[model samples]
Target: MATYAIGDLQGCYAELQSLLERICFDPTQDKLWLVGDLVNRGPGSLEVLRFVRSLGDSAITVLGNHDLHLLAVAAGLAKLHRGDTLDQLLNAPDCDELLHWLRQQRLLHAEENYVLVHAGLLPSWTVEQARGLAHEVESALRSDDYAEFFAQMYGNAPIAWSSELSGYQRLRVITNACTRMRICTPQGEMEFKFKGEVSKIPAGYLPWFEVPDRASRDATIVVGHWSALGLKVTPNLIALDTGCLWGGPMTAIRLDDRRLFQVGCNTPVAKDW
Candidate 1:
């Protein structure tokens, strides 16, 4: 059974289907590792969510920022952003079921020597510690007061990790780092505003994976979120948001042998956001 780790889908259902065809994915024999953003932006948010949820145990998807935003909007804690294409999804009959499943999805997934997170882990967090921290946020997401968590989920403050952080502050930092982060200081202070190429990653910060002696550096990390960073593959890092929504190819990598399969985007959404 092969495992294929795919880039962000952001509601690109046609492209996802094409990429799956290219890989000849079989739900019974092959497992999928999806780097979230399963819904939003493109035209088929509802279709994407429904298809992924249908995969059940054959797929493991870590929550991306867009996925979280969908939940937040569903709960009335957030508004639909300008480029959001979630109306069809929110109006669907199984909206509640799909949102519930999406909410219950992990913020980080770890197995063997591979750690799958939607974005990056802080430099100070060991794989074990990161898993524990992820559980904290996951618990809130699954709890009765999850809407409250989403209400406080949006922010750029605290900017760094601390063992002393508590409440939503703690959860927010963990969520941001794992879902939205691209560049951060060596000290793990994140910068959320810069979403450009590595050459223009501001003055003091570097890509989170480039941090020296990162505690979770021992394991291979599969992440998306930073489409500008493109499909980066190294010994311990696999960054796979190939900007499919922006007309780039939807990419998938077979984890066992690092073989890649891609399909060109069929519908390119305007880069308005």
Candidate 2:
């Protein structure tokens, strides 16, 4: 059985199906590692959620920023942004079930020598540390006071990781690092605004994976948030957000051989934002 790690779907169900077919995916034998952002922006979010949820054990997905936003909106803690295409999903008959399943999903998934996260980990966090921190957020997401968690979830404050951080601040740091970060200082301080290409990164900030002596650098960190960074593959990193929602192809890579498989986007979402 082979395992494939795919980029962000962002509600591109047709391309996901096309890519799976291109890879000749066999649900019974093949495993899928999805980089999250399973819904939003593009069309077919409801169908995508249902299909992926139907896969059960065949698929493993980490939660993305969009996924968390959906939960917050559903819980009445946040409002949908201007370009969000989540109305159908929010009104779906199984919306509650889907959101529950999504809340229980991991923030970071580590197996063997690879780590799967929607975004990047902080430079100071080892894979094990990251795993534990992820659980903290996961527990809050699954807790009885989950709405409280969502209520305090949005913000860019406390821009760096610290052991002294407590309560929602701590969980917020973990959540942001795992679901929204793109670039950071060598000191592990995150900058959330810049989402452009590598060369355009602001002074003193570099891609999280490029930070010197990153504690998690030894493991192959598979991430998908930076669509501008595109499809980058290296010895210890695989950055695969190919902007499928912005007219790019949906991308996937076989872990065994590192072979790439892509399917063109037929109905691209307007990049109005």
Q: What lDDT tens digits, residue by residue, belong to model 1 across residues 148-233?
A: 99999999988999999999999999999999999999999999999999999899999999999999888999999999999999
Check candidate 1 and list the clashing pairs. none
Clashes of 1: 0
Provide the RMSD of all predictions against the true structure, rounded to 1 decimal: 0.6, 0.6
The CA lDDT of each predicted structure is: 0.95, 0.95
lDDT of 2: 0.95
Compared to the true structure, candidate 1 yields what TM-score?
A: 0.99
Clashing pairs in 2: none
**Global Cα lDDT for candidate 1:** 0.95
Where is the poorest 10-residue window by lDDT in model 1? 264-273
lDDT of 1 at 111: 97
Candidate 2 residue 116 Cα shift, in angstroms, is: 0.3
Model 1 residue 106 CA deviation in Å: 0.4
